[model samples]
Target: MTTIPEIARAAGVSTATVDRVLNRRTPVRESTSRRVLDAAFSLGYVTSSDVERLSESEPLTLAFLLPRGTNPYLALVNHRAHAFVERNRRDARVKSYFIDGFDPDELARSIRHFARRADGVIFMAIDHPKVRAATDEIVASGKQAITFISDISTSRRHAYVGIDNFAAGRTAALILGRFNGGREGRVALIAASRIYRAHMEREVGFLGLVEERFPGLSVSATREGHDDRDENYQHTRRLLDKHPDIIGLYNVGGSSDGIGRALRESGRAQDITFVGHGLTRDTRAMLADGTMDAVITQDPDALFEAAVLAATKGTPPVVTAELYLSENMPPE
Candidate 1:
């Protein structure tokens, strides 16, 4: 299938301009819009107005909610989802949001707010009771609520479309524990937020394995970065200052650039074994420069495919965590 980037190339326009024309979110100059439409039609990415317009009984709307940030992983998935909907415009209206997933009340309100327009919701959830109640209500209202990445297991979401986070965590622990070469020292955990079920599970898995297998490694600290680069930098700097002898560092969530920076700035990048999640461009750089030792990540394309499959009630694509090291890094 032709992609938005391809359409942009054919039209001699930027992808953002292609998005403006396709999604109709902003006004485009008549000439530019015409060029984009012509390119799209030629590339089979567009339909005629009659075909594009929804019928009177049109009620198929899918909502995908994600945490608001420039987190490399989330940004990549968001772009993929938008392009998917753009390519499949005949199916249903797609409404996606970058929300404060950590804010339980706000997230719950957003879920309820979609009742008027959305037939389904796919979101990364905060494992909170309010969010669970909201999911149940959405499911009860005859709409689907699917969890992805972070899950609310107790919630009435229709399905979860992601990897086994606990296993992913264990994998990280295994890598860190083994890679340390029998040197026992304090390990620190840096997370986006424990409110996120994925981060909590990963932390638990890491801690559990460290306790069970690496009895000599003690968990020195677990700091919440809130997935903010600056916040992670600050927290990591403080953690390093407090525990100068720290040996292993595990990042269970995003904003790893900050953690990497902190370690390097503290002159501890090579001294500490750092493992993180999400194999984005940034992480690839870290691994190449020997800043990060290993990364535990799932396929991003599979993630987008699985969410859409869950929305359509199809067999969701299988997602599994893969480890990445400098030697095996994919070509940029």
Candidate 2:
């Protein structure tokens, strides 16, 4: 971490002066404060408060491009991000737009639109040539572009503010494999879509770990639901019908409610081990009712905060995944 003394030294100012600027305990000249802020920002140590004091003119305009959906987790992210902006009205001007996550042409166009309107752009990216080209073009135009939730490959996005999906996949596998009592037959994997880099990575990690550690558990079927409840329900029912050997089910994306309903109606909810991502109300209820065995999740508020930091300060915080079970579910 960059310390105050380091920022003060880089700015050729006293530590007391830096403190005064950061805390607003006393008035410091705008030029001196800008110098300190520049030093702190260069060192990847600028905080929201530091950016708060960096400018007295127009605030920095940032845009968040999210997916339009009823997925509770994404909705929570959108809510928290807007709430963050409301709280930091003096430091940032945040505009959030919901776009289709699977439409590359629309996503790419939205990126360019935000690039023209905002100082920074943060979005859930679909990994496609069109999106990658747009990312490059936006960055070349001298604006910050950060990828949220899902990222694009070969893009110029400054930072990604989400947990490691591959590791989350491996964690899901590890939990499900152990929960099967060493008598695994097959595992089914479901994702939102493989077009998002995060889903693809998670699928790879889950399959790799299941094969590496649990030899008996073969991944027999993979399906895409696009995080839609009805689609996930239909897919899950079909999977259960076709794959009687499935001893474990791993949801690499959202819409766990549909999966739960399918398993419960199939009268085999307790026979198979189920693991999924996110800690939304649906998952929480499923976990309590024994439909879900475990939830591998990251905090939504923490993720939004990291996204803001990455967008404004160029320093993204690491958001670690948390495991939730019925017995150890967090207090709301």
Candidate 3:
């Protein structure tokens, strides 16, 4: 097998430089690092066991800052992270913290607290200046900062590991429109908040598609659910009362349970074509009962693995959005 010394010689760098680039213990010039990696790959110098041994010597400590809520998707993400750490025990350790609310100052403090402790940090970011500044500072301090599920565009996050949310929105719109089948009534949009970039982007895509393709279907003004079941229930109830001809509903964020409850209470469960995000237990039941028409989802397991890989390997995995329906729901 080829060796690091041979790769260093071929790349015209010293063995120490090659080691530093491979281990990522210290910063190296981007050009030099690329050259060394290219040489190593060309010579097939590093084996999987060699990489595993290196990881065992310097195990990664990754901290995940997730939202504190009953949102099934976030719970799934937390579960997947722990599972990954257990499966790769020698390579990494994951510690997850749940931020209680949408206070950017509190979130910033949490980020700073983990800055010096973990090798990398991942979070579902709110698109606020304070949070963005904190993320950029973490990246500048030589720790990887990754955004998962949602992104803060202004920050210097190493990478984002989730589906293309705008595309997911467009896909949802396509499904909703088809399911409604030439209906000429209002479609309501519900979201967690405009502060979440992912939800905002999804809302934009959904609105654009509706305006372009479903002109006959008017859209109600967006209502913020804050991913709260009660809040979403109120929003749905209000929309139903105001728009008696509502034909479709698209929930761009969480709280499918509240939406389903409102629909059932109003005796509109079968009348409205509902499309929501996340394939949680609530959504699965709703799908089976004909309350939710389809669910737009991304694999939480894939997201956790991508975040880990990005933190340790400097390459992020791409996860695509999945469409789940009653017939195709994956078994728990």
Best by TM-score: 3
Model 3, 134-242: lDDT tens digits are 9989899888898888988867889988999999888888888888888789899999888889999999999899888888889889999888889999999999998
Q: Lowest summed lDDT over 10 consecutive residues: which window, candidate 3?
A: 48-57
RMSD of 1: 12.1
Instruction: Encode model 1's per-residue lDDT on 192-306: one tens digit a residue.
Output: 8999889899988988898899998989768888888888889889999988779999998998999999989988898889999888988999999999999988777778767
* Candidate 2 segments exceeding 4 Å error: 1-57
- Cα-based TM-score, every candidate: 0.80, 0.83, 0.84
Worst 10 residues of 1 by lDDT: 50-59
Q: In model 2, how large is the Cα lDDT of residue 287?
A: 95
Residue 176 in candidate 3, Cα distance off native in Å: 1.0
TM-score, model 1 to reference: 0.80
Q: Which residue runs of candidate 3 sit more than 4 Å off their true CA positions?
A: 1-55
Backbone clashes, candidate 1: 0
Tell me how many clashing residue pairs each candidate has.
Answer: 0, 0, 0
TM-score of 2: 0.83
Score candidate 3 by lDDT: 0.87
| lDDT score for residue 161 of model 1 | 84
Local distance difference test, each candidate: 0.83, 0.86, 0.87
